[model samples]
Target: MSPTNPSLSPERVRADVAELLGCDPAEIGSDDDLVDLGLDSVRMMTLVERWRAQGATTLEFPDLAERPELGHWTALLTGSAA
Candidate 1:
């Protein structure tokens, strides 16, 4: 599902991350652990870079990796984090 604000869908975000990491988008689950998926610091940075390319100005990898859930990341993307 996408955010209520509808800037982008969780699937789209997952696809973008998968493309940046050179993996299959289907492999990333809403609750999967990114660190367990081999998303090291470098990979996290790569994710941030990709996010920037997609127009996210305030996202940081550490924040996303801390939770690594589609819901959490989607909230961040939508600036719903408080």
Candidate 2:
């Protein structure tokens, strides 16, 4: 699912990331580089699996690891990225 997919939401993405970081979703900024927040490969792979289960089957670790930004990830997962 993508573009019109209803499974992935920015809030959910933020929460997932926040959970892995052991922080509150509200503390995460959309443009913040998650890698700087300590989002290593292990957590990134976990997100890939989680988003896949949510129907973001197109999501991959490199797609996120390359940029590691919350806003960009939301776009990718929601299929709004250019």
| TM-score winner | 2
What's the distance in Å from true for residue 72, model 2? 0.4
Global Cα lDDT for candidate 2: 0.81
Q: Looking at candidate 1, what is the lDDT of residue 49?
A: 74
What is the lDDT of every predicted structure here?
0.66, 0.81
Supply candidate 2's per-residue lDDT for 17.
Answer: 93
Measured on C-alpha atoms, candidate 1 has an lDDT of 0.66
What TM-score should be assigned to candidate 2? 0.87
Tens-place lDDT per residue, model 2, 1-82, is 2322468777788889999999988888888999999899999999999888888776767888888998888887865532
Q: Estimate each model's TM-score.
A: 0.66, 0.87
lDDT of 2 at 68: 90
